[model samples]
Target chain A: MANDTLQPALPTPESPASSVSTPQAGWVPMVLIGIALTFLALILYIPAINVFYQAFHKGIGPFLHNLQEPNFQRAVWMTLTLAAIAVPVNTIFGLCTAWSLANKHFRGRTLLLSIIDLPFAISPVVAGLMIMLLYGRQGWFGNWLLDRDIRIVFGLPAMVLATAFVSMPFVAREVIPVLEEEGTDQEQAAYTLGATPWQTFWRVTVPNIRWGLLYGILLTNARAMGEFGAVAVVSGNIIGKTQSLPLFVEEAYRNYDTEAACSAAVLLALLAIVTLILKEILERRTGGHLRKRH
Target chain B: MTATDHLPRTGTAPWQVFWHSLIHLPWTWRVMLGYLTLMLLLPTAALFTKSLSIGPAEFWRIATSPIALSAYDVTFTTSLIAALIDGVFGVLIAWVLVRYQFPFQKIIDASIDLPFALPTAVAGLTLATVYSENGWIGALLAPFGIKVAFTRLGVGVAMMFISLPFVVRTVQPVLMQMERETEEAAWSLGASSWLTFWRVLLPPLLPAILTGVALGFSRAVGEFGSTVIISSNTPFKDLIAPVLVFQRLEQYDYAGATVIGTVMLLISLLMLLVINFIQAWGRRYG
Candidate 1:
């Protein structure tokens, strides 16, 4: 089954390179690739150029001034705070969930896995709405929480909860497959050596899955930093208080402050570029490890 | 290392111990299940209940209103077109990145993920600025009378931008895993390149491509950040279902918002179900 599937996809010496080199074959595929690249470039290139042009048109002075804007600074601070809190909490939750699912053969295991994956399939906006219904003033648990004066719908709590909710599945998704593939041998060996459960987990299991965990955390941080739909619904978009960078950008765009919005967007683009770079490095390292194991 | 380690001690009764430990743990699967049920299932149930209480008559009246119907039309049509475009181009890009070695291959591969990491609101603002008549590429496309900003086309472009990654990412791994020997064998046997691709390569890829297209479609339909920014959001023209839902919620018409949201949810659920069925069938047969 595996050979049957694998054979056709990879190129081999027996296949004449003539097919790809033929003028007719080359033209169609090349044009198709060209058109695809053109479309993609159209989407990314223009906006990138616009940001650079706007930033440099007034030179570094105004650009730096814009960055120093108090709202921009606060937005960045809040975004960092949100990511710092959400990524670690979700990573821990994901680790626990992964351990349970991987080690235990409980009834409803499949159901539990599916439920854990539910957040990935559901819309972020829906996630925010779900939390709101549970914790909003007019929601089912809202009155009870309101009596205690706990606010979760329009502030940092809501933001963190929403971010965490959407991001929980990432670490688990990465770690579970690795755990399954690596098996329980090392863990059992540690247990046999009189290691307690915590000791075995910390000393034996975690090191093997640390790379996957870091990958998941990287993805989670990126998502948390950029999340807009869920945050928008729950944030109330209060200028410096509730607004993150994305929300601030949206507000600026809505109010027709195009330059300021572009400036904030450049910051976001820079973040995205950094994330892409980090992901590439991680993926390359992981790929190298896998190849060496093979 | 052996089954003995997993077995119960002579009198310890492992199953009982497991049950006891499970019960004692504060954060067990049961608790997690309860939390998820409360957070996800219950609110969705509320949305459905709210929709149901409005009755079919009220639903028909509200959902079929000219403005609402127009919004639905724009949303689905734009999403469908965008998904179609993304599927084709996304497949090509994935194919190139996986199958070819070229200058800047690493750069292109990394750039393909740029859309995934970019914030939708940021993408929206950037695209709007760049595609406006006064913007960079707009200057070139303007002479051709192609206006991308503040139009339905602009909405489609934004949706395509955000969704392009879904298709490529979904398909690329499958492409990479496929072996080339079969194609070589076919070629040695005198099969044409097109024939080999059509008979061998395309079959396994169809399922993954379809899955990606479906994901892109659903994402485009639900998109709000970029669409709202780039498009005018004028009623009956550029407004999408999610945006309309937000507008209703902003107006404090909870019932109305829930109804609209429920309708969208139902449609998306149905679409996804169909796509999944196709995926299963493709995997089985293709």
Candidate 2:
């Protein structure tokens, strides 16, 4: 664990950028790798495996039984609906923001960038508080909403808003860097060739950033599906009505239905695993394309 | 023709020129700002107004109440401890992944982000299960009398889990971008491995490590879902600030909740400023 990177790093006389291709540092790298792996196994891998093992420990009977619960089904539907709404909304905003940021330089540009990143830095719990402050009864717009007979908090609308806020920055964050790297040269060329702004965006810019956009959408979807803290605050954790899968796990555990909780968790864990695998593929794919383009 | 073709040629007012140029951009900045305001800015502004509507004296009292202070203590101390732990192991993990050759490496590299993708509620459940007295790892430590789950230690573990990826991801790129000739130069000059590391490697990497630690600390401080479940939520013991905010909200003490939320918001924003400053410093020096 100590000085793991301090190897006998002798890059073969001017082997351009391939810093010490071979590890001849004997047992050091091996020992370091072992320590790191052991640490990760205890902290991450073992805990992750525990989720699946606990889910099916009572055999497939209870696992399937837990999944068949109506609330569980509702929770799954609610989660997908939230993701379906939040991901596309943010994806479009991400594209628009990326295009605007990439196509021009202006005052407050850094400020705008920072604002896009605000939701990420914010605590999900506080994010809920903000929304509640705005839309809850006795809130700033409480009278207006009450006059209109609207219930925003403790319902699907606020849940969607909270989910959107928490996952909002992902698409923009992922796409901005890619667009900045690609620059506006291609878009300008398309415009000079008499293409409309939308045409230039769809034909030239979108193709160039499709992988990045997909990467962002993948993260946004996974987060929207898995968001617990913010959604918990805003959704009121209503059993069959507002409970997303993550909330269902909490409620099930609270009810001493460990099997149900673990089963629902397994579903989310599967989603996360899928997200991770796709993320890896995108990173590798983007890496290859980025190298070629540059 | 493009939007600029209609611009008045001779006496274009400055404001008119600004508006015309803005409209002619490939994307509409209006919609971008409008969305940004509606989604992020407006809600945040509401929180500020609501929280600050109460006079400063009262706001200060609520934010620094004994219970609130204790929660902040647990939140900050535990998060700092977790982030420091991550700093050590995260660097080691990044080092091994970047410099060493090993099998299943790519999968492990990707898995560092598991905490980001996996729901925290699931993480909390599993951690509680695995660290309970009769649980897998807990059973081994039971005889030693070190309780983990349902304690502050459990909260720290949860924080550590979520914050691990930040440090690794930040430092990994910096480590990869480093020049090897400096280290080779030091080695060729008869510097010991430890000395070469301290003198040649670490100085350049310090800013990145600090930035990662700051980001991780901010993240851990804001963490709610997992810590809420892992900790018993005892007021003066293991409770975190975010959990405290939830408790206040649950009790319908909106004022109490908003005050604490504002304090946490300010601290998290301060952390961000510090991170940005560190990155700028690193860019200039490293």
Candidate 2 error regions (>4 Å): A1-25, A288-294, B1-27
What are the clashing pairs of model 2?
none
Best by lDDT: 2
The docking quality of candidate 2, as DockQ, is 0.51
True contacts kept of 1: 0.37
| Candidate 1 pairs with clashing backbones | A7-B182, A8-B179, A9-B178, A9-B179, A9-B180, A10-B179, A10-B180, A11-B180
lDDT of 1 by residue, B116-224 (tens): 7888888888888888887777778899999999999999999999888888988887887787667666675667667777897888888888888888888888787
The whole-model lDDT of each prediction reads 0.77, 0.87
lDDT of 1 by residue, A1-294 (tens): 232331234344344554444322435556756776687789776665666677668777777888899998999988999999999877877787787677656566776776676665556666666666667776767889899988888899999888777677877877787788779999989999999988988888889988877878878888889888778877878899999999988998898877788788888888888988887787787873321000
Q: Ten consecutive residues with minimal summed lDDT in candidate 2 chain A?
A: A15-24
**Model 2: per-residue Cα lDDT over B1-286, one tens digit each:** 2435666667888898877766765545676877888888888899899877988999999988999999999999999999999999999998889887688988898899999889999999999889989889988888999999999999999999999999998888888888887887766656656777788889999998898899899999999888888899999999899999999999989999999999999998999899889989999996
